[model samples]
Target: MLGTIIVGVILVIIVALIVRSMVHDKKNGKSFTCGGDCGKCKGHCH
Candidate 1:
């Protein structure tokens, strides 16, 4: 019984970690820096 609870907790934690890293946090990183608009800038300030 106790072991089953521990295993369930571990599985939940593993799933949480997997879900956490599976997607990108759009706000935390740079936006679309693709060279689609190079016509406006001499060179990217990147």
Candidate 2:
């Protein structure tokens, strides 16, 4: 139906935006897996 198509399109757009943001962060040297606590990170971010 029209509603289903609209929902699917919206979901795809949302996923695309998320991926774009992740890529931007990666390009800026951001770590998605790092907890931000270097002491506890145990050199994982290194």
Candidate 3:
């Protein structure tokens, strides 16, 4: 019904946001946990 459509749209938006964020982080050379730099390692060590 209408409610289901709304929920689907919201989920899609949320997923799109998450994907955008992940892509942005990747372009900036960052990891989810290491925050772009793994101190103990060398260059671009994500």
Candidate 4:
């Protein structure tokens, strides 16, 4: 119905925004795998 369509559209928009934010962070050199605990990292975060 109309409600279902609206919800789907909203879900898509939210997902797109999340993806955009992740891309922006990546462009700024943000690391998603580094938990800021370099002591336990596998030395690949850099």
Q: TM-score each candidate.
A: 0.50, 0.75, 0.73, 0.71
Candidate 3 vs candidate 4: which has greater TM-score?
3
Best-fitting candidate, scored by TM-score: 2
Query: Scored by CA lDDT, what does every candidate get?
Result: 0.59, 0.79, 0.83, 0.78
- For residues 1-46, write the lDDT of model 2, one tens digit per residue: 9999999999999999999988887787766676344567676765
The per-candidate count of clashes, in order, stands at 0, 0, 0, 0
Clashing pairs in 1: none
User: Which ten-residue region of model 2 has the weakest summed lDDT?
Assistant: 30-39
TM-score-best of 2 and 4? 2
lDDT score of residue 29 within candidate 1? 44
Better model by TM-score: candidate 1 vs candidate 4: 4
The residue ranges of model 2 lying beyond 4 angstroms of the native Cα positions read 35-42
Task: Pick the lDDT winner.
Answer: 3
Report model 2's TM-score to 2 decimal places: 0.75
- lDDT per residue (tens digit) for residues 1-46 in model 4: 9999999999999999988987887787766666434456767767
